[model samples]
Target chain A: MDGITRLVYGIYPRSDELRVLISRTERGKAVTGDLRDRISRETEDLLSTFRGSSDIYSEPCVNWHDFFRPVAGFLTGFSLGKLQRYLQTNTFYREPVIESDLSLRDRFTEIDPPENLPAPLFGNDKEAWLTLPSPHSIFQASKNPSGIDEEKFSDSIFRAYAEIATELGRKGIVLRELFPYSDRAPDFLGALNGKFKTILVAHPESRSLPATGRNHKFHSIVASNQLLARAADSYEVPGIYALDGYNTKLEDAENISRKSEIAREILSVPRVVVTSNQHFDFLPRVIADRKLAVLKSLGAS
Target chain B: MTGGLVTQEIGSFRKPEYLSTVFRKGGDDVRKLIERATLETLGVFRDSGLVNVGVGGEMFRWEMYEHLADHLEGIQFYGFVRSFDNRYFRKGSVVSKIIRKSSAHLEELQFVASHATEKIKVPITGAYTMTDWSFNEHYPDRHELALDYADVVHEEILDLKSEWQKIGRDQVLEIQIDEPAATTNPSEMDILRDTVERSIEGIQGCEFTIHVCYSTDYGILYKALADTALQGYNLEFANRDTLLPGINREQRTGYVDVKEFADRLGDRILGLGVTDVHIDDVEGSDLIKDRIEFSTRFQDIGRIRINPDCGLRTRSRETGFRKLKNMVEAGKAFTDRT
Candidate 1:
């Protein structure tokens, strides 16, 4: 049985650093081209390390503003654009920033496999899995109000994703998987999975039925399945369904069991991944106590 | 406690000196005031032969922002700072305090359970609403933050169950997790279900109830109930037409068409709302009875618990007591009909 593994690879320091940078930029701190290049290089290095460490999957490249801009623009763009004009009097095509972000993400496909890394790291046996912030995540981060033209935003996102997938395909990347972090990401999953071959859902809750109203995780999967079925009906590219993992709460053994059972049944996907491993702070102690096996068995290995 | 009603004083902790000095000076005196108010209200209910009493006040008080500021960083700090000015409580602190207050309240409920001949009900703000209302920072993500809050609630439930078991009480301890925010986002239905499951994880042996109402959106809420593992659900059926959207004036008149919705939900216990709390005047007993009778069409509904649309916190003392009396009288009438 093929199992899923969570290899944490992304821009180092993650959103925290990006937030600081954005704040600084807003404060009129000149972020030089060299500084931007250094940040990008550091991020690329992190992704390369994550790719080299395991023969399993490659991590998604991070472009902070790109990942954020489109959804933010869609949700708060009108108001933000108005504010920017009133404040800075600069006219900016927000779409170009979003497009450039996609282009930066696509640049990962061109990254030369590090020379010191073993040949198996770039071999056909290993899959290159990239985790993008789900459109729902973008919406959440942007703090956009509901009832926007989500369909149009989803279309644009899927088109950009298709472009990236096509570029990665040329790089001999066999599989491209997108992980939807938020519960509200099913619609985007529905849209993108049509183009991407494999899709993985990481629902955070361990309990509750998948169809419960407003349960976005369940909704996303259901919507994804529905979209796939519709595409199959229309002779569109048939995507393969992979596993769904649960990022459950601590000490919630019963819910974990319940979720594992449900994943086995409803998620026609190939695997069900669970995590017994705690956060980064607890990793050392967990490994020291040989508790890694417990997590490994749950598919976090 | 008789039929989910317990006679207990609303405990009020002193706020900082800057805000309300009256509550600080009158700690014991305030407790006496609440006790006196509760007894006086109970006397009126008893005179009218009402079986249950609902407390209408903001009883639990703690400076939670100050407590939680001690644990958070940067964005979390800014979030809390923004929330503090808005009078919003932190999710972690609120859950922690609820656990503490509920444990004490459960003991008081057990005391009432022992003395009374009927079941005692304890209502709490549900996990979803708590997540919606509170500032969260413990987890890196919102869903994770919600799960963390649910874990806190689960701990409280386990603690309360153990305390009840130690006391050897035969009376029912109905724990109502109030979820008004369940309707706002359909995606949250899953989180609500997960939170409910976590809240009731180990204590499957005890009676668990969920109360959801007071918001306009029921699309996700109805779906959440279908997917949740809850044993009993108390919904706002009264004033259904007036409050709920998509309902025509014809549906609002004298009765609601919740029977079909309830029937579709299968065997879960249905605690139908018989009185409209949003209204200023207390509903007459006959009107409450009619509402309960209308809900009896759903065959699976067991033990119809009569209640107003929500807590009587907004109602006047006389009005709240009169409504409770009418509700109890209506419940007795329904029991007699059965």
Candidate 2:
């Protein structure tokens, strides 16, 4: 857990103009190869602007504008839920319902990096990571919360994740960032213990860290600072403190540095990854950029 | 409180798939689709025999918050943001001038009010939810931000009222303010109370109902809101069914706490959620009646209205319609006996 302080940037935010463009394109006919290229290039252009930010800790989630679209195929009876304006921080996806046993309906091949996202944005020579909804998240987030056969559901979700992780790994993706929205990360991670390499568990919600098992093999845990504050002793692995929140105000760099420093002290860990508790997509690009610059400065301090 | 147990929708009916596509094009097709969708929804509610009918917020393809945000200024629709709870927002704000009122809502309300032989209720996202749900970039405090939103809502309600009069619609309809984010940050209860109160203020001649879900701690906020001009409280009860013998509390089941809400706020008309929106299997009318009967243990039967726990947009049109039909049947059966 020592000597491993990596600044991570999970996903990139799209501008309103780009969102309209994407919406129009999505509502239009099937995304042609040309249109896909255009959207990807435009998305890359949006991301390239952030390449100069020294503290842009993580790889740009170039194609993650629709967070759940990639995993939409895993659920048998997948229906998109309405755009959650308030709770989702104002982003929308089909509230996916996993009605039956999970299966790899799609080849799980499209889960890899798009060819258009420039390699330099992939952290130059550094190892780049990819993010996906965890099996637990898919199950917990689904409509069928009860009557889910835990062992069977776990197996199915594990298989789907393993297949996707393997495919991403084959593409030389170094880390697979799995978002475990459930409080059962310890159980879920333990199930995937020896299956994948460099798996990072990031919980978007501010949930208490689960009790650690002896076989807990997740590389790192990313969660809310509040959750970490409540259950820091429960975590056996190094934790990345998500410092920004729904109301995380724009403060001066000094104030941000102080808060970052306090979070570090509270965790009492030598290695700390400063990141937003949720995606910074909620803020305007200017504010998000400013916040990132401050976070980068905090990382430097 | 009324002649029979009132039946209403919590808001948001599923639009036909092609209608969603056509409505986005926005022209003659959009108007036709709105009318068709509105009629289809009204027909479903009317067939269900529901007296306190919803206009079936079919115009909203997105959820309540974003749909309202789309019509207002200062809100920039950011692309998809997904979380564990699957609740995301269009990255925007309530910070700007809300020039665009929800005239589309009033249009739908007018259609329902004119056509349907039942009391039409118009549901809108509440100010506290609009403030609580959005990223508050402009306001110095959430309380002030929520009040700003309240002012906007108040203005919209006034506009809606004006529109309602222009069409000669009923003056005594219901306006439901949905505050799904009310309990998201429970520490802001006073702010939420003030926001709700102010949102419904100055808009006279209609009944105001506040709908908050997923939390029983609404007692605190409900008490504060009760001090205002609020007339009714619509809350989720069936989704949180306590009738289940041994279900865990956290698994989105059981209504024991709803009883608490009912006990605390029983003087007001209570719109009880008798259908669980998350499940696909339509609940039988007997079960719905049982849930209503269970509620009668706490509150007066006449004061109770039946609705699904939340919007039916998440379900298929088939499933949503069937559930509403069952719910209406249950409401009628329960009223018949009572």
Candidate 3:
């Protein structure tokens, strides 16, 4: 048994100081250099506190407007649309509007590993990774006026994303699918799993597995703790169970322990990562930090 | 109907800076400040020519959830969580059996009852939202938690009714159950229907309306609330609408739901959102008239009402005032032309 491993994902909540600075910068009052340093300061605190304690992680994407927003830079045909509610939560994300057929941006096309991609916060730590909305999710949420081919668009997204992460020289990529998938989503995800160490963070109830790919399995799958608590389920993948990401009420230690025990029994593989279900952006910084502290304590059980 | 197109305030306005300061840092003069702010906002409403002034701009409360949860027992807030619009609100977790510790809107209504010259519509947070926003730590299931919250809403409504009775038994008391979270989650649709129905059970001497804001798919809610006891639906549209001014379908795509709303629940009132609340640029009176005229294709002129997409708390006091004044002017202009 690989026992238990802890992981982190998504943007950390911006500090109130940083929020004020962002407001200032938006109002044309603050300098860019100070804002960058202020943004890094919070992540430095997190990394120093628990750098290697968590096995697989995504750097705090506090600067990105939303999950799919940065992906616009990697593609040729999309721009940020209106802010949409992120699934059922109070959090909102800017929907990408595809005015024309999406193709890999010239940088992603010409450069083998684009040297221009943003530097990873965790550097070359093998467990550190980058995440974006799954191609299926992007396809579903985006407004495609030109009626792009689903399969072709999905291909470009996976190729460009894989190139970006491989060049960033990080471990892998996380494909986050919080909403219900389009019927063809499973097939699109299958193609993405063929490259580099890949992990899929889907809804707790989603039963999508790698449909057809060169790599038959993801390194692991992280899902809501609800998956393991269910009375009946048949899942072939090793699971990283997680607690609610949005709620501020601290999860009970006893209950998390119980769910991990259940995870061991239910998952197919021995390696089971435990973590928070979604990004901490929905929560206050202090509460999310406490929750992460709880996550860190679940090492190598 | 009521002889003219009616104008209403959605819920909270930008509380005057002085009152907002008191609300932020509590002081002995908090009540007095709220009363003064309410009276001041009422004067603004009177000048704007509104038919229904919503508790003189909901001045007694800081926000919907924070204000309502503050009055409820068995709910404890942990810390502030970021809202969809980049603001933060203190979301509570239900720890024990939930009950109404006091009325969220009784005093606001009482003050308005004493002073308001215009018809008053009281906006209370609905059960679905109260349950949806709270962490369900104590309940066995979400439905049970929602039902208990319905009890809390029911009690608050009863309390308001008694106050309304004290002032005017012969007059109709208007209740706007604000459910911004009503259609946000489709899984909770059944609970939303059940809770709205449960909240108004055995209640009388009132005209009930539901105000749902920024819902992703309002079609689901038009169907969901079809079985509820609500008599009106105040939905947000202008927030997503194109800004062009015309009385045709192409120029008025946001009013598409008005047709479905009329087809499904024609008898119920449709509180059409004729202005966007997030932007400070006031919609022209002609734009608001075009929006209203578009809805008249499906719903009758008498059954229609107009308001901002949601609360005006996001806008500055001046911006909010202009938006309201434009809405009232457009409604009057439309009625006069008809």
> Per-model i-RMS in Å?
15.0, 6.1, 2.4
Task: Output the worst ten-in-a-row residue range by lDDT, candidate 3 chain B.
Answer: B78-87
> Lowest summed-lDDT stretch of 10 residues in model 2 chain B?
B79-88
What class would a CAPRI assessor give candidate 2's docking? incorrect
Candidate 3 C-alpha error for residue A177, in Å: 1.9
lDDT of 1 by residue, A1-301 (tens): 2433323322122233433453454445746343355455545554554454433333433333222332233222222221111001011112211222222232333332221111111112124554444554343333234344545555555565566556445221122122233333233445444445433333223121122122112212212334433322221122222211111122333444455455544545443433322111111121212322332233432
After superposition, candidate 1 runs with Cα above 4 Å error: A1-301, B1-118, B242-257, B299-303, B333-338
Worst 10 residues of 1 chain A by lDDT: A82-91
Instruction: Give the chain B TM-score achieved by candidate 3.
Output: 0.97
lDDT of 2 at B38: 75
Q: Which stretches of candidate 3 lie over 4 Å from their true place?
A: A20-33, A73-76, A101-127, A182-184, A190-195, A212-216, A223-237, A246-268, B1-3
Local accuracy of candidate 3 as per-residue lDDT tens digits, B62-131: 8888888988788877666666423567788788999877778877888888898688899999999988
- Tell me the lDDT of model 1 at B77: 25
Best by lDDT: 3
lDDT for each residue of candidate 3 in A118-154, tens digit (9 for 90 to 100): 3222333444577677887887778888788777888
| TM-scores, one per candidate | 0.44, 0.65, 0.89
Residues B227-273 of candidate 2: C-alpha lDDT, one tens digit per residue: 77888888877765644422334432455565666767778888888
